[model samples]
Target: MDCTRSYWNGRKAVHRRTMMKGAGYCDSDIKTKPHIGVANTYMEGSPGTAHLRTLVEKIKQGIWAAGGIPVEFGVPATCGNVANGAEELKYEQAARDIVAASIEFVAKVHRFDGLVTVASCDNIIAGCYLAMARLNIPTLCVTGGSMTAGIYKGQKMVQAQLDVAVLGGESEEVLLELEEHVCPSFGACPSMGTANTMQMTGEIINFVVPGTGTLPSTDNLKLRRSKEAGEMIVEMTKADRKPSDLITRETLMNAIAFAMATAASTNIVLHLIAIANELGIKITLDDFDHYASKLPCIVGVIPSGPYTVVDFHYAGGALTVMKMIESQIYTNVPTMDGRTWKELLANVEAKSSDIIRTLADPLFKEPGLKILKGNLSPTGSIVRPTGVPAEMKQFSGKARVFSSDLDSFAAIERGEIVAGDVIVIRYEGCVGAPGMTELMVTTDALIAHGLHKSVGLISDARFSGFNYGAIVGHVTPEAAKGGLIALIEEGDIISVDTVQGTINLDVPENIIAERRKKWVCPPPKVKTGLLALYAKNCRTADEGGAMQPWLDDETN
Candidate 1:
């Protein structure tokens, strides 16, 4: 309505008008129309983002058709799979801040009417969601869809954490064969890892249009969805519907419900907290237990079950899952379509009962997520209890200490790590590692070493969504922050009871107190640049490792 606020008369407008003219935009095209920002996180060398460059064009076409001028821009995305095994992986979490800042800068300085945030994977989507909340603009999201399952020896082979984790002990012959076939397409990992998990979370939270998350990138349906999202943002702008309108306390709870019901990534827990922090919701890790305890794990997809995200999409995507759990969701909550959740799910149903299981016959007996508190993680810790057997849920073992994932992985390869030991990887938290690196490789390595069932791993780090076993992570206050995890020593009896939701380091209370007094925080691994800045700003994993203050609890 007031498009000239950003252009047409003043000195700032003169510069904007000149730029538009230099780009060959006609007066009619540049005047009196809503200017929508298409913030695309498209990059080469990463399968997750490679296709987005082409997909953005379709979005632009839809914007033009809906009487909006599409202003396209770039955002950075890290391919966690491609950057695996190097120091580069340590900066992955830091990139989330970068992605959010870039989008916020463009939207604020340019004064766009609405925004369309597009990306795949954890940090990228989380960053965009944060930007949307920070800007509080008429906004929508389009996820780069899931990769199709690869066919290996007539069996469906998906690119999953299980595939990566097992590489540690695989024979050379098997490794050679897997390198070519594990991920043969350009999309996020086929399994329900962080990318797919975040995408589905976006849908559940109503940040994106329903049912658009898990479509295969190669499918024409994904293109149509992107185009539709572009069109929808223009309508959203017209109706004055903003991101803050859709992402609310109820919607955020609904997102947690989806994550739990699907047995989604533990990483989702971190991202969700970061997002809620941006909205000034002050969501804590303990808040998650309420939703997790109530919601049943329904969808049996990857890491947790036999199927991949493709199967989940075909079985009815996020809307279908929401429908099955409608009784649990706040149905009065609004969605991107400017309708209530009840309106959106009025006709939604699961296509197949087998893939998307019902509450009556749920996939997991307990909630997928477990928030534990004990001497080891008095601040708290997180673990995925789904897919973990009853015996592994409650166990006690001697601690086998390792300072980092690489050290533990090397020990496993050298046959030094054995069953019945609780692996402790410390100094890898948000502040400790500075980026809080994914522990998928280490978890995979242990599984490959044939000790996943017998051994348990605890860390101040995180696990990939593909990870399964008695592994517990996100322990806080982390080693660098003077948490008790840093005080743990070799052969100390470590107990983890997932059923009871407690993880403790069995030691004398006086000894632990003495250790806390004498313990000195390690020097920042990264002394300068973004990592150092992030180390200074980031809160604990229990608070979602959020750099923002609103997400943090000072009392803890």
Candidate 2:
């Protein structure tokens, strides 16, 4: 089997087939060389994908010891800890159409020449960033990393945010013997939420492998960086280099300015507004609040900070926050490693000022993430812009609507919240909760009973970058398209500003024309499967939470 390679149709195939051609090995040692697919989301009760099947058996022994011919594939997970009896928005729109039609049917019907993805959590890296902007091949995303330090009762706890803080006061067979040494084969939950801020902002926009996004998946440098990413993907399948040659718009505005100075996850502004509308490029949460008011939070982990994701990979990853915002990045885009994010932060070395912070010394002067714009998100709602406060950023509050999330966890078990109320959730979104759950046990029981600075979670759909407060996510004509957060009521007043991005509902227009003459439109939660084709082709998180016909050719 002359060192592998295969492609049955779109050219190249002296041999080597098998999406399952009876598993053996050489097809004339993969003729015509260069077929590297590897996608692998992995779930059957993933102990974080059992360290991704031992880093896919060392990336198939480094793609057959590096001659290129690694066809491995399997994507199907997102139960978010086995949520039991299905229909959890059909397992999140069947994980965004099984990673958008399996990277457009494995690169135009078995026409591979590079694709590696891997993934860890949070809807497997938002369905692998909408299948790497629709599989522009020669890809490389390997994040079967992060899981170590869990130790409850004397602080430090991560690996699955189940900080029952003493396992919710013990008993119950010591929570079944600490779930048998709590699933660690390291690889996700070095806690900075949304699966380590979308795979370290998908390797600060190169889609993984520069400081291998917080390596850990039970280390050995994640099995020698998964066999040096299968010998650097046979030199990116003989130098073809796809992934839209380094996802542009100046590297997606340096990954929305490093997810706005690491205040990451409002589901990374809904998967960077559906991977910049699958790359027509228009990412707004007001361009994540104009790059979170001119960037500079410097990797302060967690629901906002207190580290993890292996404490942001020993405080270096994103090459030391791109060398402390090296003049707010764009240093001529290009990477998967052809060089430049200013040549990998020219030897970065910022070993902590409390995990990289100092653009003239700063941490929380704002930019955890906030971008609201009135009439209850008239196409704007996202709050986290750093541990919120400043009088809970201009809310008027009173409304407490909750038509779902199990009637707001039965009003948090009938404690029917008080202290400046305003929790409005609804039938969730993405064309009617066809997959937008994660309010994370009512935003961690309103931040473990401190009323997290006087409550404020207003949604339509989407949450859980692992809990933090003053919530408001992806709310656009949601309430299943009847927006106005379903013409809200229960004691309306709802203001919410978050630094002028808005959420208003201080109603007036004839009491919203008397509730739009009694709106109805509810019925289609699952007319059939794949959440009835993403509730008939999803779109509207102000047009970039994907499915506006899978965005691209520069979306309108």
- Each candidate structure's TM-score, on Cα atoms with residue i matched to residue i, is 0.96, 0.35
Roughly what TM-score does model 2 have, to 2 decimal places?
Answer: 0.35
Error of 2 at 495 (Å): 18
Best by lDDT: 1
Task: Report lDDT (Cα) of residue 377, candidate 1.
Answer: 86
Best by TM-score: 1
Tens-digit lDDT string for candidate 1 (376-473):
88877888888575668898899999888888888887888887889999998899888897886677776667688888999998877778889888
lDDT of 2 by residue, 446-551 (tens): 6656565787878877766666667777777678888888878888888787776678888898988889898887886667866667667766666655565644
lDDT of 2 at 349: 68
